[model samples]
Target: MPFRINSQLAQLIEQHYPAVKTAGFHLSPVAGLTGESWRVSMSSGEMLARFHSPDRQISGADRRREHSILRHIARHNLGPCVRLYSSPWLLVDWLDGAPLAEDAFAGAAQDVLTQSLVKLHHLPLTGYRLDLQQQFAHYWQHIDRRRLTPAWLRLHKKMMRCRPPAPLRLSLVHMDIHAGNVLETPHGLRLIDWEYAADGDIALELAAMVRSNGWNAVQQHALVQRYVDAGGYRDLVLLQQQVNRWLPWVDYLMLMWFEVRWQQTGELKYCEWAQPLRP
Candidate 1:
């Protein structure tokens, strides 16, 4: 969890944050699936420097889009405060928190999770809507299909044929909302890693949360009810139906992310994760 920062990396950090020049500081690498980041500790204050991917098409992270969302979400107290957003890096106030565990996420902290999502959906819609079909197609282009297993290829074909249902309501949606992405801060639960967040169907966001976290029928139903009670949705039955339709697509996207990342980085972990997901 702790490592020394080399001179080159230290110099890079200084370029992004000049305040580190005067103050004693420490740099530790943080675990990230794709892009690299560091927890910057300084005598003055703490901050996080999130590096953006060079090939945006492959990583599917729109830093500009994320910056736009963050600028607004910070005012609403939904996310971290942005200090600077120069190309290839974003500097923000370091939030003191721990990532929620899967057990606590579903068992004890489900109410907070549900309420936070309701608050997210209430935010004004960004102009861009998250298009999963296009995203899938983009990822597929980069992956080596010739090396893909028959099962993965079959899932790809199936995803291509399946039509996603219409939106229950169009709003700002955090497309990724697993336990690891939710931070338990002193103030409250806050969502992090906004790389995939954008304007989309509320039902799609719910489906991603349920399927990724492996929520059971009862847990899923309870979430829908809580969302409705929080004034997040009107028709519970309709939203549930839409979420059901989006489940398979969520599986497809998750699998493709792993496959594409594997191809892009030659990282065996991505391949390992995909093996269990494949049919």
Candidate 2:
């Protein structure tokens, strides 16, 4: 189905760039799980427009916060430059790059990814803290408890028992780090989708990388070693422990997300994703 820009959005686009009224909007095929994006070809150049997902709040996403973080990161040339922001709509300078392939995690890409993350973690605090347990509970509230299997129930119990270490050192983390969100440009590897970025334990970021990338135990160790090599967190033993602690929480959050998405779209793929946890 062709995605047509609504009258309201079209008017907003015209208001910002009147030339768009003539050249019109060209929708990008790269639709995200939480937003519809487009590339508007103007007489001057190209601009990226995004319509944030209505279901964003269910996952505790704040577009304004994301915009603020993007602006901060753009200063360091890490993300796209923001041109305009209006409520759920955001327009930014279009980036010319390709999303990393699933198999692109090895070799130079892995090194670049590690260095990029280390750099991001070193950034000053953004005044946003991600409470994983709280987020889990929030998502759990929207899910039907009866839908969970004994295995999932056990996992949830285990996650409840685990906790972050004392006096946690928080850093700016891109919680949703994965191949899809990473773009390989001429400049370097740039991370997109700042909606889930916040101040959190660096180990949580490591755990997310492992889970989202489907890394094996060896691969996980290698990635962590690379991170450590790049002057990230010391204390390898404690770092591994922290990463382990976040694994269950990550899985639970994603499981709840899949359930909520299934409920919203009645999409069989979401149900299929939820089934493995359903015994």
Candidate 3:
């Protein structure tokens, strides 16, 4: 669906970007998991503006960090160039390509995705460490207490006590990685949505990717070996162990995220998805 921007929204975009001749601009809505995104077409070029999620309490997103990360990565060609950024709104060059679909993401797609992620993982720290414990605490506090079953509380307590493997090394890790987030763009494979991106252990990112994609041991090992082969430093055994150790945390985080999203949108799908994930 196209985002028909009213005069108010049009003025807001124009206020931040006056260079685009008033001859006109258009907003076309783009579908995504979080945030309201619209592709803005102007005389200069196409840009995408993302409004922050309505309930930041649940998302635990820091737009300032996201904006900084985008600016930092775009220079390295790992992501899109930042067009403009202000509170609640981040505008960047519209990535012009389809997401790496499952069929297309195999073989060759895997190669480039691995290559790009290695480069991304090697970048300088974004000065923001991802405090999953702190974030989880925040979310758990917000979720309706009535819905917290004894089983769920038991699992949550266990998760809270479980300590993940220490960071072998920290880098600018793109916390969100998957086929959908990787665009097969004209330039190359570009990773979008840096909201959850932060400075963290690279293994955690890999673990999250593996868990999110439902990859088995063989496939997960393929990713680990791929990273190592792509010049990304990894202790073959240690990294594999770390990935396995982090899987429970990853799964729990995903479940909580879905629960929070379900609450935010009142969307049955999000709730339905969370059902199996619940305790």
* Candidate 1, residue 177: lDDT: 85
lDDT of 3 by residue, 213-252 (tens): 8788899999899988998774788877877877887888
lDDT of 1 at 2: 18
- List TM-score per model, in order: 0.88, 0.87, 0.92
Local distance difference test values of all predictions, in order: 0.80, 0.77, 0.80
Going through the candidates in the order shown, the clash numbers are: 0, 0, 1
**Tens-digit lDDT string for candidate 1 (1-279):** 112223444676688668778876887667853335777788878878777665554768887788888887887777888877876667788889999997998777878778788888898887878999889888888876766878777877877887777787899988888888889999998888888888889988888888777788887888888888888898999888888888888888888888888888788999888777777
Cα RMSD to the true fold for all candidates = 3.1, 2.9, 2.5
Instruction: For candidate 2, report its TM-score.
Output: 0.87
Quantify how close model 1 is to the true structure by its C-alpha RMSD in Å: 3.1
Give lDDT tens digits, candidate 2, residues 158-249.
66677744423689988888887889998888888788888888888898888776788888888888888898977778788778877766
- Candidate 1 C-alpha error for residue 131, in Å: 0.6
- Model 2 misplaced regions, further than 4 Å: 1-5, 19-29, 32-35, 149-168, 277-279
Candidate 3 lDDT score relative to the true structure: 0.80
